[model samples]
Target: MTRKPALAVVGATGAVGAVMLQILSQHADVWGDIRLVASRRSAGRKLAVRGEETEVVALSEDALTGVDVALFLVPDEVSARWAPIAAAKGAVVVDNSAAFRMDPEVPLVVPEVNPHAVRVRPRGIVASPHCTTLAMLPAVGALHAEFGLRELVVSSYQAVSGAGRDAVALLRAQLSVVAGTELGAGPGDVRRAVGDDLGPFAAPLALNVVPWSGTLEEGGWSSEELGLRAETRKILGLPGLRVAATFVRVPVITTHSLAVHARFENEVTVERAHEILATSPGVVLYDDPEAGDFPTPADVVGTDPTWVGRVRRAPDDECALDLFVCGDNLRKGAALNSAQIAEAVALEIGPGAGDRRGLGSGQGPGSA
Candidate 1:
């Protein structure tokens, strides 16, 4: 641990991976060496990282050699296959996939929330929560800490990009097809226009808000809805927390937005919730509807922090409060969280954190 940590960015050429490289450049000087890794087809390609053009290497044991922290920003299948390889090669793998998130041995970490969980990494690997969950977790976590959260109800307005590049292209194509159309172009019109360009989503995402996001699960709930319920409970240390979620895909490009109604053990007030979110580490408070100030995806697309607004106490339930939150799905929801985990890991391995060899039991801001 004497030397600076050597970082490896898995899936270095993908959408979230590119954002990871950009974040590394902006947050440079934390790690010593940076390695760009991608698929075999993209292995020989070059990518600029921290102003230097670095060659992309295929995921392999040799490529993972000497890597202190490996960020996997690939598909869940890829992570299921390659993350163990990276970890086996002495790298602390911070995975941004759904593959290992629910695994009891792998901790699903949000730096602003349960960072202390980073310690006891049973598999030497950590899982980053899905992007949609991150859209409001930081804000909710802060409020929960102060109010003793007991239940949650979240409605998500997710962007098309959350599905990936193909989904983005599908939305753009559909938008172009209806650019000059009239106002009331019904659901049938959108479905006919989008045709076969649905890509990953089950329905057309342009000019429409699909009530479903992620694959349909048992009991009529989507995977995204289930993920939000599970992840929030894990991060907040509330295994039996009652959570009701509805995930919808909106015709947007970047950020994910959520309307959260969180019920706490004690009564909550609009003023108190605002104060907690304002000073929260990863949350930005922007509530002032009179002055026309609220967090929107378009306004916060490229930002780092989770933007929170529309703070109010639920009229019917004194113990519940409402909030609207938005954040860049690709950055804070994916790449930034992975980088923060790596930074947290590095801190434990670095000088002032005390004996660097005890990373498994390391304790700090982002441990678990």
Candidate 2:
């Protein structure tokens, strides 16, 4: 019998890493040896995966030696520095950072949206889109497939967790400060309560919503917003597609939500859009606002599918539709997508494909 592929779960102790472990435990036992690797401080710790206590090895060349696949859930800098090393070592790297998203050599993959693109990785790396972009792409891709998507205008209500553990902790701390008092009604009230320590966010995120979420970019666009635009166009295979996005920080802990306005070359209707979303893989259509049945962050957290609701044609335009979408940032938006890509690689490796080391030599994605 062919042996199963060996897998390395890099960044195995982070927030998204925790979810990736849970997903591995919950999903199929397709892997042979599941190696866990993290920072030096987290190296000796044990994490539960596939119902076993796996001790994390410190990130090093030896840790990734002989691994068939490496799933990177680390920061952009860490991924930037390490992912290429892993790729050089012959492990197909599925990176969840912004390190290689725009690199022409690396394919930015959203399994539900563009699974076929996974096959052409010149860099032996697959980049997952930003959490906000992932939160809405399944539905958008589905609609685009049917309607020839021409443009997109989206506003994202992002959870603090998307910013990472420190941001989550900061939000919790601020919440504790403003939980009991009726403080938000007055001007400067929330500002005085959650004074400094906003973590990665620009302002207080407990009783407030900050319109900014990423570093400022050219033309006043946040990096996150520009990422949304770039990732959308690439995933949809639509170069020169017009996309405008505004990312905001909300108090939610896990799920990210988006309000999308999509314009299509062909006329669209609410019924057709609903039907498309309902049938699309990795998407759930939940549009029944009269009965209070619409996608919300609370209802969608910890889930894998993108929940879409509030579907309607734009009142003034026959070819435009509006939608509200919600998805778990840590799940589909990060860990889950990376895991899915790894699974795809596993399928290519199949059984008995021994010694895949140095396998990513400009080979086709399925070249095991």
Candidate 3:
């Protein structure tokens, strides 16, 4: 008989947390005895799991007891506070926040890109790459392996869900107002709109794009852009890798798309790049320009794989390639990536083994 691993999901009431539950439910054979944990305000709320309702428990020291793995989907503050305690208590933590992604000790992971990094977790926490970074990893790693990546330039068309649940609500409300206006509605209907309040965004997100995401950090880059730059370098094991990112908040509900141009150390052709991408794990090559085939957020939303298309060789082939990628920001970008890390950890630690001392045990306090 196989013993199922006990699991805890921090921030179980949040958007990514909810998707984490769904992904786990879909992969029940790999996990068992799941615990949904949230903040005090969300405690006691019931969430549906496999057609059954599970009560959410408050995230406390006691909640980590006996769990084999804990997946954190909470904000940076909450993750910073509780992840260490959870690790110390024996649960291996797979964190899906920016809090630990850049920490040298934490294995910033994308399973297809750096599964080996899982074995070097001096810090108990393993971090999922930022959504943008995660979306780009499969394809980039493939190219890197074949041609050696030297520099990367990326611009992201990010979805509102990347902002949070409130952003989704705000987008929906704004769309409703826009619909009313398009149908020839009055000023009262326009100005006193349902989504006039941009709680999750800095400006109106209904029909406009917001260049900023998270707070502005040093060098005019928003936290979101910096996360992409930093997490990409860490996961690819290229500390000095040259990367620049522009993260923009689009009106879409899910999936983030990236336009990337990368220069490689060795010469690479578009056809060769396509071949590598086709065989790479977690990447689906969709480059059929004749059929107008290219990845878009609308096509990738709710999907697990990173969809790739529009492959081209840069005019000045200083060994550079250009590509377009789209992926579900909530899935492979966040929730599924965390779950995959936990699965990898489980495989590394061996089936039914709950020891927390090993790198694969999914147990360790924060190294950050």
Tens digit per residue, CA lDDT, model 2, 89-194: 7778999999999998889999998999888887788888999899999999999999999999999899999888988888889989998899899998898888
Compose the digit string of candidate 3's lDDT tens values, residues 15-107: 998898889778745666778999899999999876779999988888887777799998988899888888787667999988888888788
Q: Which stretches of candidate 3 lie over 4 Å from their true place?
A: 180-196, 354-368
- Name the top TM-score candidate: 2
Supply candidate 1's per-residue lDDT for 280.
94
For model 1, state the Cα shift of residue 248 in Å: 0.3
Model 1 C-alpha RMSD vs. true structure (Å) is: 3.5
Per-residue lDDT for 12 in model 2? 96
lDDT of 2 at 244: 94
Would you give me the overall lDDT of model 1? Answer: 0.85
Higher-lDDT candidate among 1 and 3? 1
TM-score of each: 0.94, 0.96, 0.91
Lowest summed lDDT window (length 10), candidate 1: 357-366
Report the number of the highest-lDDT candidate: 2
Whole-model Cα lDDT per candidate? 0.85, 0.89, 0.83
lDDT of 1 by residue, 136-234 (tens): 889988888898999988899999887888888888988888788763356487788657757877777767788887887999998889999999888
Q: Is candidate 1 or candidate 2 better by TM-score?
A: 2
